[model samples]
Target: MKLKTALPYVLLLLPLAAFAAPGSQSGEIRFTGQIVNSGCAVARVGALSAAQSRQVEIKPGLKVEVDTDRNACGHQSLPISMSYEALKTSTDKGIVTITYL
Candidate 1:
């Protein structure tokens, strides 16, 4: 009888155990490659956000597709770079593909 009573308590702690682990629940992947000028990469993923590093120069003619949380999406082709310090504080999520030119 005591063993049976403890089962429910054990079950209740499972959720807490999962959260105690360090990692992200958000489904996001980051990929980096050299910018090769003319090819475009498509990332079919979930909610997306982007940040560019200002301290370094991003390859020119880079394009991105930010498919919205909804079925709708947005695209951008620009030149920029992100500072390492800035990247640490960024909340940008989703699939990132870098094409080398």
Candidate 2:
């Protein structure tokens, strides 16, 4: 008896439910950007023989790129070594002195 009264309304909603979301939907979203550093703390600006390894020799004309697992700005490695966390903290505090030989 109640079904007879609700039959038309249920029939109307059946189409809406079936077509609301036909099937599963999926895809992908990706993002990209550019980061440019205007300058760095050193005697030279852009020109430096850079190596992405620590085992490489550090000569006067060479700027050994170190701790680059994070960004491209980690060059200018020295005879000294410091953990990335420490270096970041040090830099965040103030300018890190680079003694000239």
Candidate 3:
């Protein structure tokens, strides 16, 4: 019968209908946004004397102290908090650089 012969062709063409139009197929659209961390401005209180400018090595167990001027911030009532983050470089292994914005 003609209907039997055309049934196979109809089934094959049904899948091709999905590709008939370029980018016309119904699909889910997704939108994404990211919030990047921004760096805070820090004011150092004391003048950097020549003695303080010397490069010092920070050992794992030892602690190095650097004095900063919190008065410059002017927010006396609010507690001051500091955070440091290290970002790894794509080209180097075991090497990280800090970014300040």
Candidate 4:
């Protein structure tokens, strides 16, 4: 009779015993990150004077020069080289391509 009465209680406590077992522990998960400034600024200059408001014609094979400023970038920024190519689309539109060297 006693065995039958205690059997139900033992079955109910089995799951609780697993969670309270020896060497059981709880810990917190930690995460860390940082934000940094990067990248340079580029400016384009056309051959036309500032006072001239007319549209300037650019030849297909002409080479355009651009100036880059790195003063705004952080000192930790590394030196890098780049190349640019010009491609003409089927619709007679111009596309500029940039490559990192």
Q: What is the C-alpha lDDT profile of model 2 across 1-101, one tens digit per residue?
A: 99999999999999999998657556655569754532222323343344433332234333333333223334553434322222465633333344322
lDDT per residue (tens digit) for residues 23-83 in model 3? 8437868679854422223323333432222122233332222322332222332123434
Cα TM-score of candidate 4: 0.26
lDDT by residue for model 4 (11-98), tens: 9999899978865346655578753433343223464233322221235443443223333222443233333434454554454443
Q: How close is each model in CA RMSD to the real structure?
A: 16.1, 13.4, 13.0, 12.9
| Model 3 RMSD in angstroms | 13.0
* Candidate 1: tens digits of C-alpha lDDT, residues 7-101: 99999999999989878749888679964443332333322343411112223333334332222121343332222222455645323434332
lDDT of 3: 0.39
TM-scores of the models, in the given order? 0.23, 0.25, 0.22, 0.26
Model 2 spans > 4 angstroms off: 26-101
Residue ranges of candidate 3 with Cα displaced over 4 Å? 24-101
* Overall lDDT per candidate, in order of appearance: 0.41, 0.44, 0.39, 0.44
Score residue 33 of candidate 1 by CA lDDT.
94
Q: State which candidate, 1 or 2, has the greater lDDT.
A: 2
Candidate 4, number of clashes? 0
